[model samples]
Target: MMKKITIVASMSIVLLTTACKTKDLKMKEDRKEFISNKKEVVYQVFTRLFGNTNTTNKPWGTIEENGVGKFNDFTDLALKEIKDLGVTYIWYTGVPHHALIRDYSAIGISNDDPEVVKGRAGSPYAVKDYYNVNPDLAVDPANRLAEFEALIARTHQAGLKLIIDIVPNHIARKYEGMNNPNGVRDFGADDDVTVESKRDNNFYYIPNTQFEIPDTDAPLNGEKNPLVDGSFKEFPAKWTGNGSRRAKPDRNDWYETVKVNYGIRPDGSKDFPELPAHFDKKSAQEHFDFWKDKDVPDSWKKFRDIALYWTDKGVDGFRYDMAEMVPYEFWSYMNAAIKVKNPSAFLLAEVYNPDEYRNYIRLGKMDYLYDKVETYDKLKDVIRGHSLPDGLSDIQHRMVDIEHHMLHFLDNHDEQRLASPEFAGTPEKGKPLMVVSTTISTSPTMIYFGQEVGESAAENAGFGTHSRTSIFDYVGVPAHQRWMNNGKFDGGQLSESEKSLREFYKRLLNFSLNSTALMGAFQELQSVNRDSSWGYDPGIYAFCRWSTTEKLIVVTNFSWLTTSTFELKIPSSIIRKWNLVDGTYELTDQLYQESKLTLNVTHGEGRIHVVIAPSESFIYKL
Candidate 1:
């Protein structure tokens, strides 16, 4: 998990004269419908902190001290700004009821012991109640689900889809469905606790063994819990969420929640029905039809119902956390059911195994999976000087079969910040990496909210030390807070450089969302230039993306400290395909048009003279 992706930077800013003050103003003048091949841009906003105005980033801070962002804070204007960023989907993380240090017993919700929770506000993955919403996100705790529903409505009204998390692998240690519909039953409600494993039992419990609190350091003991006596008793200890069989898991383990038993017995034999050979690449509707009368484990049905409940409430998709850990057959059932309800739903997963990528997408029915282990990791090596830019071409070559389903990203809540000391140390270092990440494939692109503005997670927010933004603490993100400008939803408080970096992201993302060439054809020019006689530097990565109507010759510099001028050649074969005439032509960098690049053509080979800034990219269109 420690091995990860890092920073980016830009060449120059390209400001459109028609750029209006806000999204509403710009849309009225320049907005256009999405074309046939434009990529979907997913903007992941950590829901709890997106609109928080507080700057006091106290470690393990309480909601009152750090201050919590509300559901209503994602106003119509805020949603529009995100929409204008060309985002098709908004992954609203931390929307469900999780194990946090809060008391909601008065409203039929049971309390989670502080010793079992992860930060002052526990991880969003540990669901305390599947039927309710996180009360901390609501202006009125009693109306939390209503507030989230309203946020969903606002997101759609602003022309963006909403994606929430569906963590099926585990539930909170204190799992209780406080608001389950009349016919539904909470997990473990009908289990026979004496048994260690049963095909239909919701949990794998250690009979007669009481669960012990992990011997973690005190700051995270979480505000004087009456249950922190280290004997937070469970008569029969359930298996820890990370699949640790230990009744007392260590602090380093996923000790916050318990894993749900999906009928995978201790011997790893499946009790549920397996997918047929023909179901491998079948349509979701086909999968749905296949499972219409089949019987599944109770846990599988519980999760499918949860997904459908949200879809009925207008939520368009889901981002499954640690999806590979869950059984494939369950996903075959759940995803197919979800698709039956909403065909275009965006279903993404955090799957790291390259070997299992195709299985998860084709058999598991996942729409997208993380490219973190492939191109993303290779890009990091290029930046850290561990490898050359050509390594990226190898990743592309191997992923050719499933390239479209691979999602590209430079930043996410789980990764280090673009400006973190552990990464590239400045927001200015993110532009070039971002350019390649966005344009290299036809897959969807995602950017964490603070990523565009270069949010350096210098604050030691609770569970996470630094580098990555804290998903488990109530801390305000510094750089993002500046962009928020006390709920103004404008970058009025950002530094000059921060503002410019944001402008670069805005232009780049907007272009990616509207460019047909990006979703058209991808031809690797890195190898061509690397083996060229004119001497191309290893820090430079060039490629060609084109459609019948649009063609882009992209060149990106991975060197953070060296500026270079080089001849980026557009190959003879490519030129012939474009039917470009044999002549000298002046081409403009579509991203930063201040300088004009000269392209010379002779004997079908075309060469362009370009001066690339350190850690910046040039997107030239003719």
Candidate 2:
């Protein structure tokens, strides 16, 4: 009897273990399913300004006076609040070490000459070290990289990925990689400075020209620095970051940086091998295989190693600055190598030329490119009342082939703030524009820090003035501070209007995150409704997005004073695609559930009447 009881108990334990294993496997599968289907929403935060509580508006203020935010400032509560905004990724801009006018000689970090730097903080694009984090952003300067790694771990723990910048086209005028690993030499260390261009040289020298500082009315902006004596020693000046082949670059040029040469000669001829014909259609792994044994430039190898090093340290991806300035072949080799280490690394680039979009995405292996020239420009005009909302349909039609590869943003560090007088003059105006930009296609949506709470960037911070946030100075973003609430990250100090706007953003963004239709097929409904009895006008833009199980109807009213009431028509083509029968279906607003609307389908046609206020948008579930 005892032996029979023991056998029965052993059988029960085995069955229970098997059941638990099956449940865990299913959970993993579900997580992967959600990751593959959800649309990505990226929150871009300027690393220095995100958590600064200093209210001092001193122009050209030093870090101690203005107070800089540290990596530890991104506390768990702070990251959780950001993740709760429906953000899939957090892009920490200015994480890499850059030239700044601070005396860090105690830590082996040489102070940058004010004559060669942009502002007190220096430009984030002017990278001084690729293998190290900005010392200014660390609580303990000696453990700067470790602090950044801890932040990376915290960000991932909050279920959000992290992205850092990689300025591969150039480096700080005085480059120094203090944290470079063994056997990895610094950029331009072995350069033959006597030649105009060499196949293996990291930089292109002007042969015999000496570097001359650009003439400026206010040298060092009146800052008294011994090094700002209108002299910076450089033998055989290299080309400027903006491809200016001059010994003394123009004041407006990227004079603080020296350009990296990727085997492209000064005469516009390729010194390296070009990608083979039809190579654009190959996968990243295939591209990786193709370049494994190919002879590439030293600059290319250095960048690839930098990227891989960051990846091994838990960096999820990189945002390539001025990507178009570099050769596409170099990107193919560099991005492919990154993919081999981490297949899902996010590779976003700033390629403004619309003509080179496909070549950059396909051959360059970039996952996303800025949709600035086409979509962002059109939307900017529409919001400024310079263009009708109807023009968005034409823009969307042109880029249908590569729509998903585009990333949309209403404001970035490079653009004016929505609440600034130079822009729309009110954060409310961004409602319709944000709705259109975020849900217009299957592209990723990006929101700059302080955008949600309406940061006007009104301070006249030395290097960069009003209209845009100053990336080149030690400063604080006021409206964003209200949201940060002294690192509570709970929007405790925000005004009612600011809170309401942030809530609107939260709802729309969360909807986009969970909705399958957002990442599915899209069709414009404006052209069909323009002729209908619905009184559809150019000020109104409407569209539809649907998948096998979910369908959405989105409409926006761009006029600031006009409240539009229209009978939006979903034509027979869309109705057939959606497979709707002749019945009345409830259409609920996903953004604000204030409107009671329904779609009436009759004989293969769908119609719904919507009343949208000025600067209002409706994302309806049909």
Candidate 3:
């Protein structure tokens, strides 16, 4: 009897060992699959302000007094520091040659009339030249393009892609492509200016009327230039960038820029060829083939060549400004060309209308769009204690089909700073908000230059007021300067709170980038926990992200004054999907790794008691 029992025990031991090896092999396969799916992290820096160390921050300051960051400022060390921050793409905002108030005539660049310029530095969207880099961004204005190319090489050397603005909807009032390639003509060079609208005209004209500068108190920088005399010479007034029809646009209008006519008549009818039926379902290569032999509008050919020019220069992608203002057909054509040239080119657009989101992605062939109207607005409401966290579930549900195409960001050049009183009154509130933004979906995440260091943007920088950083003025970003630390590119002068905030950003961003589960399936646990668990409140949010080999439970508390002690629950449906059974498991905080919690499962349902301090978040990995 003893010999028979030993044989049975030996057989059981072998079976258990086999099961262990099978489980290990499955885990390795799951990891390989997860690694194939990558989530991108973009770091946006205002090109003129990122490396500027001068803290003068004078309102309406000149580039000489306030100083400007050059292409050389993005040294190998600076690029390395940005890459170490877990950024995959570096968006060099305001890199293109735009209409600025500064004079660079020695390099054959024309001076822009200050009356038509936004501020001393001018708006980057008001692009003056498309074929050349901004002369103001070069140490040697004569070799500006070469300097920018060097920066591009350094960016690639640091193992990061580069993105620059491509403003397709409009151009500066004083448009001039001085460095246009041989045989390439300027935008309006071939236009018939006497007509109100033409299929091939680059701009719309209010025939027989001269352009008049809007009546304002003064030029944004206190009339520093002699040319700020309330006059800009245009033979026939063109339509304003915002589609104003009058000879004199309102002060609130986008007066600094003139609209580009994309074969759409003044009556809002398409004069260009429309896409064929069911073309949205076709591939980009198919679209490219369709337009290959077809005759397109002149403006179409111009912009396409411009985009191809930058693509040839090693620019990895573009952030198109006000893309929705242009026709969807143009994007289908333009994006198809870009994709054919560089199959991996990242195409991000600023499209706000939610109804047009799918059309832009499917037909326009765009990779991503700003989630401003839905996700951004809803998150801001939740952060301000004006709404509950449950609404995020509804948003996720609505966007499930295209969730991966929505790029999430808490701060950008266009938004109010998170640390400003106008936003959340403190940078600490960003902790929970950012935790949600980065990990809530499979979409890419973006971080503005000073967002990590809590730049309040309290300075009233001339044309732009307090709450948002000035894109139109030559000014120093104070918080970012401390991080620059006199070109060392380290946070040498950062305060304790600022340092902690940056570290929090670093931890969350890095984890979100490398975590395989974030790029996998996601399920919101908010509704389930609220219905079944105790200590649940509107201030708390919970979700589950899982892959074949990894599972994560994320929870955040937005309340600045109240601590949340809650029993977070993961429902049976998600448990079954995660292939989890009735058992006890250990969950550790992936962000801080400072705590370990026990998750007890029974009947396929899991529950864990969690204590989230005010404005804190946890990515508990199981």
Candidate 4:
């Protein structure tokens, strides 16, 4: 009876903490004036797969069969070539130590059970050690962290920022903090199993329960684990990463990982300090100041320390995985501490919920969110011929408030390749889309490695379906291997078509990288030109963008079968805004400057004739 009363008293103390004053939340209008500039090209490379030359792709293959890439593979010359693609930052995915099927038991790491790991290489999201680098990426396993540190130095030397993944939502089911620095405590090391929920407990436990291994009765990869004597035990089973409370989670569920607790009760009410209602209206530093003196939960502090430790290692930034799954307050707390360590840190996180976008940004302190579901999805629909060009206009209108804060990309680790059979089936089909995606807004643009030469990702990797490259298995990318040219880092072995495709990506990406208009002002001409021509196919779209010194008209034909010629009209409003008089101006295709076209202005309206081939786009500068 006394223990029950003590627990109740502690719960009351947690619920009775003072709330922040709402008056402090009303912020100055220039709240976003201090956001770090992120107008650079980010190239996301699944590091383990990027430079792997091995082509022996067998299902459920071992490291010796399907070889892994090392950190040294990112040679100085290789990085320079990527820079030639106009890349400013390189996000190295799967850098941290994660669970894998291989036996590193010789060294302190043990082979993870197949039932608890995703693929041969394992899912990168299931980090095993927060303080160590993946030994697979090192030339010498004993010096993996040193090799990664050298890579960081090399990336900075090549004038590119380095980005690594930080998965805050969960960790490997076999979560053990190996190689933790002094004073750093492993998660769940001090948990009290008697309680169902505690503010300081790192995980939520279904007390008095034991975890049941996922239902994998059928042999995985045609075999079952030799060590499986029908059970692997864990008393007081914790909730799975996907919020599955069942001890026996489904195979499709995130059974390989366990969720991290951040002071949210099982009923979803926050048990920690809440940011003031209008706190997002204030500057980022002010948000930081608000939490500077507050008592935060233990999980929040641990993640924050992890971030700071990396920032101290000269890491320029982090790309948070499934950021929205972790509470926004944790980001608000963690990112603030990161900024204090490195003010210009590039913090890009993946978020899908449109409704939570602003809160994740202004309150959660995320620098950029994935522009996937809105822009990327709509654009993909348009490319596959199921949707019209007007959807882009709708997206632009919807994202107007936070346009610059959304990062645009067609391919990432999680998405299908541009050339996969399930997608466009060829890299040529992505040219027009790439041009528009990179230039349509002022946000940062990201392109995956091998996306330029059209990596089909057709390898039947172990745990994942084909279409997207296997971040989980060690597999060589065919198209990219040609460009790697073994150790030459040149495209000497590339075929004519592959070389041409790379050239196209280079031209489009470089223009976006250097164009003043792209960063200055944007005005969509889609509405005006939608009905300008009689045969005006909805497959074509146009827009105008300008800076003081740069004024241009951009047009693209999304069709793969139709070569369309049309008179693209500039609305009277745009012509007047540009201060064009009743005269003719010479316009040249910046991409293919051998061609010149004429734009005639009459009665304050501009008329330009354009002939574009299938899957073609033009940047006409006046």
Whole-model lDDT per candidate: 0.82, 0.85, 0.85, 0.82
- Tens-digit lDDT track of model 2 for 1-622: 1111111111132211111111100012222321357788999999988889998979888887888899999999999888888899999999999999888899889888888889989899999998898898999998899999999999999999999999989999999988899999988899998788998999989888899999865744796888877789888898999999999999988999999999988888998888899999898999999999989899999999999999999999999999999999999999999998999999999999999999999999999999999989888777775655665766677776677789999889999997788877799988888999999877899999999888899999888899999999999999999998987788999999999999989998899998888877777775566555444544678888887788999988777776777778887878887788999999888998877698999988988978878788899987
Summarize candidate 3's per-residue lDDT along 381-414 as a digit string, tens digits.
7766556667787788778778788999989999
In candidate 3, which residue ranges exceed 4 Å CA deviation?
A: 1-36
Looking at candidate 1, the ten consecutive residues that score lowest on lDDT are 20-29
Q: Count the backbone clashes (under 3 Å) in each candidate.
A: 7, 0, 0, 0
Assess candidate 3 and give its lDDT: 0.85
**Model 4 over residues 30-57: C-alpha lDDT tens digits?**
5236423235899999899887888788
Better of 1 and 3 by lDDT: 3
Residue-level lDDT for 379 in candidate 3: 79
Off by over 4 Å in 4: 1-38, 217-220, 223-226
